[model samples]
Target: MEAELRDPIAAIGLDVEAVDLSVAGKRRMLRVAVDQDGGVTLDDVADATREVSRVLDESDVMGEQPYTLEVTSRGVDRPLTMPRHWRRNADRLVKITLVEGGEFSGRILTSTETTATLDVEGAEREVAHADVAKALVQIEFNRKRSLPEAEETEEDDA
Candidate 1:
């Protein structure tokens, strides 16, 4: 389904991030996660839904099975499993758990197909893809840029 829907989804400027098929009672649920460079919007999801439904309806792929199709954006809590995922998350803070039962958090500095360089408290560490069991980006909100403003405010108050 992914291969068949790739071209159609790409036509709408969306990329198929993942396809999940599960059994919901007697019916099947087909969840398709779509994403793009910046992000996916409601319009994008709507377009992808229509395109996927049309393609599936016109094809014999579903084989008369009635399934609920859900199109959604990539969730922030989604695990980072691929190099492209790491690349897209560059400069973002992430918590990684190793297959060997070790865990660490750092900001992603650079990434390649096999390794990622992270800034771990002013120190750099390189991690290999094979060593990571799970990785999730940490959400940062209203983070200020540097301490210059705070320092200047203190000087004025004095």
Candidate 2:
């Protein structure tokens, strides 16, 4: 049953993050969470849900029992474990926890197949691929300030 839903979804270029099957009363429900490049959209969720439903209907993977299916994206708080996921999110600040028990906060300057470079303390540091215990994207904000009066007045007078 799991393969029934996973195979078709993967074939369509959608990622299946998780799948859950539950029984409530006399009916069963299937929940699937999916994601893809640039994040998952409502349309993507809907399309996957529809496709899975169609496949299940045709294959009767669940037998004669009645069931429901729900498909959605993994939330923003999802852990960054895959290297590709990290590479795709380059240029964003990230909080990385090392295996030895310390944490580092920096911006991801670049990423390669087995390692990533982080701009820490104004210097680039190379972090081994296996040393990262956990990593998450850091939300950033921009601030604008007014120029000093001398500069402002000089520009105005000129």
Candidate 3:
């Protein structure tokens, strides 16, 4: 279902970040989370809702079952499973649990299809995608880019 949604959502300049379906009593719940580079808007949700509804209605995909459709955008609390997910999360602080049981927390500096370069303390650490078992963005509040830190980042940028 999510695969079916990717193209339509991308056609509208949005990415389908997640899709979840579940049963709630007599009806089914179809939750679709969409996002983009700057972020998603209410207008985006409305448009996506219309598009999704239109596509679903035109096909027998749901199989005549009545389901509630919800289109939304939100922060995800799941593993960084795809290269796009890692790319989208660049510059965010994250806690990673590797498949080999090593755990670490760092800021995502950058990513490629196969690896992510993270800023661990003042140093850079690169990890392969296959080694990551779980990765979640960490909440940050009142973050300060102090002068020295700012300069250091600028140097790294060079």
Find the candidate with the highest TM-score and give its number: 3
What is the per-residue lDDT of model 1 for residues 29-113, given as tens digits with 9 covering 90 to 100?
Answer: 9999988877778999999999999999999988887889999998888998988788888889999999999899999999999
The CA-based lDDT of model 2 is what? 0.81
Model 2 clash pairs are none
Worst 10 residues of 3 by lDDT: 74-83
TM-score of each: 0.79, 0.68, 0.84
For all candidates in order, the CA lDDT equals 0.91, 0.81, 0.88
Best-fitting candidate, scored by lDDT: 1
Model 2: runs farther than 4 Å from truth?
1-3, 22-29, 59-67, 140-158
Mind giving the per-residue lDDT tens digits that candidate 2 earns over 9-114? 8877787777788998998888887877677778888889888888988986688987877888865566677776677677778899998889999888888878
Answer with 1 or 3, whichever has the higher lDDT. Answer: 1
Residue-level lDDT tens digits of model 3 in 1-158: 98888899889989998899999788999999998877788999999998898888877878887999999985667667888788888888999999999899999999999999999998999999999999999878878865788788998999
Query: What TM-score does model 2 achieve against the real structure?
Result: 0.68
- Tell me which of candidates 2 and 3 scores higher on lDDT: 3
Better of 1 and 2 by TM-score: 1
lDDT of 2 at 42: 82
Off by over 4 Å in 1: 145-158
